[model samples]
Target chain A: MPLLDVDYMLGLVPILLRYLPLTLQMAAVGMALALVLACGLAVIRVLRIPGLNAATLLFISFFRGTPLLVQLFLFYYGLPQLLAFLTQINGITATIMGLTLHFSAYMAESIRAAIVGVDRSQTEAALSIGMTNGQLMRRIVLPQATRVAVPTLMNYFIDMIKATSLAFTLGVTELMGATQKEAAGSFLYFEAFITVAIFYWLIVELLAWVQRRLETRLNEAYRR
Target chain B: MIKVEGLIKRFGGQAVLDGIDLAIEQGEIVVIIGPSGTGKSTLLRCLNFLERPDAGRLTIGDLNVDVTRATRADILTARRRTAFVFQNYALFANKTALQNIAEGLIVVNRWPKERAHARAREILERIGLADKADAYPASLSGGQQQRVGIGRAMAAQAEVILFDEPTSSLDPEWVEEVLGLMKRLAAERQTMLVVTHEMSFARDVADRVIFMEGGRIVEQGPPDQLFRAPQDPRTRDFLRQVLATQVALDVPD
Candidate 1:
């Protein structure tokens, strides 16, 4: 059992730092797509329209019940076999597709909870004041729901950052993939893994700090 | 001006409002009083289409609001002219008091933000909450939140405002402030329909007082007549019980 080599770990810092932007990009892109899809799904669920709502519920339940890694593999491998169109899609798109679907399902539930958390009487009040359904949702319900949902949604993004490590399984050379390649070439697994871990820690801490600031600002009106 | 004919509302086979008929004239303040679970609040809510009537004809001004037969557009038109205030002061918790007041004006009436804010400020001032305009409902006291609710209704320029136990959730000291505001509104000839347990406030401000029991209007008339000489035995019993409770509280230890 060799003692931990601080010098070797320090030397790998620059190499891992080079891959930082790629990791952040994957997380950022996945989150943006998930947010848009989640918003549509949440609105559908809240409105509870015929046929469309049932379909969305099935989509959400399926994505949420399964494992994200399995979903990623299915999108990257299984879907291409069934659909000739998806065969032409690149690995990055496949990974992003998997990440978006998996996260959007969870995000939809969080948003729906926030929407439901609003007082039922508020909707009645809005209707009594002559607001149409669309007007009520757009002007009253969603703006308030979004504020409540923001902190929870940010937590999902942080989780998605770590989740992007699974993208390496799809042949996308993101942060984790790059680290594996470096580890194999240098035969220094511990150093390479430690360097990547530190990079992720830094990014997660920064995001968590931002989330706190945002929650505070959103709740400024209620603060004494 | 409102007419309700054969109004019937049921929840899961339990009849809440069964075959109620009433006519209210312009510039009249009608206070509805009833025991819990007697459908007084539901009756006020149905007048504004907040709760759709299961069976009946509700005509506010010229629009019909019977869910069984009315067109969607007609129902929406009727709702615009009638606003409802909830017992819990259902002010939008996330918005400031001013934003709550301005929401209907900007969203429903399509007023510009500047114009809506100006009107909201004026209405808040009228409600005696000008100093707390920018505060959120969660930050305000229960009475202040109810005042914001009143201001929100006023800003919508509703022809008729419905109140469901507006002071039920307020403190004893705070109750007078809100009832005072309602009294001032009544004095200015604002058309209002209120469901309340405060017999004194109803007697003081309402043009007509209607007592309900078991989903029917048991007695209705001018406040002095109804309170002094309630025609029905049920009304007399209710008044006697309420007065007994007050008298028991007033006795020294």
Candidate 2:
């Protein structure tokens, strides 16, 4: 009856924490898959490899223009209708598919920009020293581009962690779904949601700490 | 030995290097001095096919390529036999000095990593940057970075080194060290073709000095004759203007 149930919020923390792994698992797997796909798309975009380049651009536009929640529904509901095999995929698989497709589009553009941002002189220097084009990219260009892309890529990863909360909409019992179930049974909606928010906040805070360490390590070469 | 014949390069339909003909014997130091935009840098860049001369022939050691018709293999072979130094050091930002020096050795020459690193260490010591081997380009002084750039060139053991205004971007304080390194390299009878505005370096280090104008070699001779008594009117006028500016800069305010 009170304005807030502090003790109940405290008690729900353990219950909500139980679902943290599911949330993390979704984010980790989705991000890993997205990063790999994004790198491929970025390389295609950078090279402008004939037919594949135009297709990559259209794919990026479609994924980026649509809402993530709508994309999730399409993957879960719409994909099964077109592809018979997809009908067997559970809610978790569909949610992951949605996340991977959505995030990779954004990541592809950022990675391409980072690669283009590398100094032209670096390429010239590599070529002058007898490096093949492939060697130039692998040894000189990408290493420098990695320095430029790390912060942006880490931002996308954090965005990915929060984006996983939307997985519950697909009927996947991730963090948000678990909270919804508990809230419905007890009718302590605010308390349950607040506990879930704290879990997400803690995870993001831990990740931010890791990102700082990674940035410091990458920036070591540039330090005066 | 290196030879370039009828090296022609055009930008926007205007010739930058118009039918250049040059040859250098092994261990000869040839210095090119000309007014800006006269194609001194372009000629050097064309030797390694960096600009892909419109029509020319380049022969270094036993390798020869027609610039207009050179294949990828020809360009790679040409580059392998020659090294270049830029006005801006252009050291790999992500690599340490040692790694930059060793990169060509391992990647281009296909030497084992340990052998490359060992050679890199000797080059670093020779360049007086032994203690900074682990330091990245960003942390080194401009002089030190350019030394590492030169070390990278040295580690290649190319038949000839092309220097394109190597000290032009340096702070005045840093210029002397780079030029001194070049002097030492020249003293060792290394084959080098240098384009620079440093009259003193040309006079002191170059075995032969070439004067270019309008994308052609207007005159060439020993540095004593070229600097002190240039025969061509264009060369004389260009040298007078450059020397006047040099004297003006040297005068205390």
Candidate 3:
């Protein structure tokens, strides 16, 4: 056999592309779940809700400091034994849950900083205008903070799509899982991995383009 | 009428405002002039419970709140009767100049969006910023932004408007524009408590003037009396120190 199998790599591309949807699904669902949870966690962290901030801090520290691979294995293998209801969790569900939990910890910090970055004067101005607390948060504060958070959130989303490759560890046949089988059948490891890498690169480029446009729109008001 | 009594605020154990008491009649324009750190701004803030006085009583129109025992409802009710203009032109930076003025109406007054925008546009015209309706605060000059800020307070239409050094942050070229707007509001007999350093504006526009020092009202009287024949030694010293500059402006080179 030749040292390099160019034909095998080209053939692996279609097979891996078939698995791209599954990988995209894991990332999209996990990111949607993480976004909601992160926003709540960020608000709680920003407000310093009495008696809960310590718990939140410890939770963030644990998730942020630990390796995601370790967390994924723990959630996929160790969790079902600890919780009876978790026994029904499948490989895909476990992988998504792991991704959501891990990514939310990181995103929460970015969101908290974005919220706190909103100027105090904005709060005072909204309140002085007789806006209720709800109105102030929904209308004045969040919109401004969201603009500041968009680039970071997009970075997290792109990170997540790549992270879904780890789902193979949980037995989910996403892009990486399919690539592993193709590599085994043909013993063309380099070709299999390159095919998957190209797919990821394309996805990242698409998302980065959207991020650039969004940043431009967000900055339009302040632009001279 | 707006009645404030026994207001006190402590910061790191020192009282910023100690035992402030004053009354302003309906449509009265009271200008508060004092040295920095003397609590003139703090007193105006206490009226709207912005600084949350450690102990005080504030009555704005029919709403009353005791600082020590006030409920959340009581606080909001008191806040609704009053409005504030900030020293640094705290317009909503994310919004267009017109939206900044309309925010209060849409949120607090529950006006329909179209109606609030219509009213905001009229206020923009009234403030001589009709062309800036669609411009965000960052795009506007300091004078244009400050005028939009004043229009926000005007749209609030509260029984009393508390100004916290509204013109102190402006460039010298822009100060006259903001002060001229306030002078017009004064002529309309809007109830206002203005904390400012523009002594000429105080001398010319105030219905009553209050001099504060060391967090106490040293003296208060009609502008003519407070400016020309202040009774308290602190008041006389303050006016002399501040107006010595005005005296120079009055005399042509």
Best by lDDT: 2
The candidate that achieves the highest DockQ relative to the unseen native structure: 2
Q: Candidate 2: which stretches are off by over 4 Å?
A: A1-7, B247-253
lDDT of 1 by residue, A1-224 (tens): 56666777787777767867777888889999999999889878888978989999999999999999889888888988999998887777877888899999999999989999877887887888888988888877887887899999999999999998998888878789988998898888887888888888998999999999898888886676
lDDT of 2 by residue, A58-77 (tens): 99999999999999999898
In model 3, the runs with Cα more than 4 Å from the true position are A1-10, B248-253
Q: What is residue A135's positional error in candidate 2, in angstroms?
A: 1.4
Tell me, per candidate, how large a share of the native contacts it keeps.
0.80, 0.81, 0.55
Candidate 1 docking category? medium
Estimate, for each residue in B1-253, the C-alpha lDDT of model 1 and write its tens digit. 8889999999898899988999888789999987889999999887777778899987888776665687778778878888778889989877899999998889889999999999999998899988998898888988899989988887767778889999999988788889989999899988999998888887789999999998889999998888788888888878777757553222111
Looking at candidate 3, what is the lDDT of residue B147? 91
TM-score of each: 0.92, 0.95, 0.96
lDDT score of residue B132 within candidate 3: 87
Count clashes in each candidate, considering only residues at least 3 apart in sequence or on different chains: 0, 0, 0
In candidate 2, position B147 carries an lDDT of 96
Cand 1, B chain, TM? 0.94
> When superposed on Cα atoms, how far off is each prediction in RMSD?
3.3, 2.8, 2.3
Give lDDT: candidate 3, residue A112: 96
Per-residue lDDT of model 2, residues B17-62, tens digit only: 9999999999999999999999999999898778889998899988
Arrange candidates, best lDDT first.
Answer: 2, 3, 1
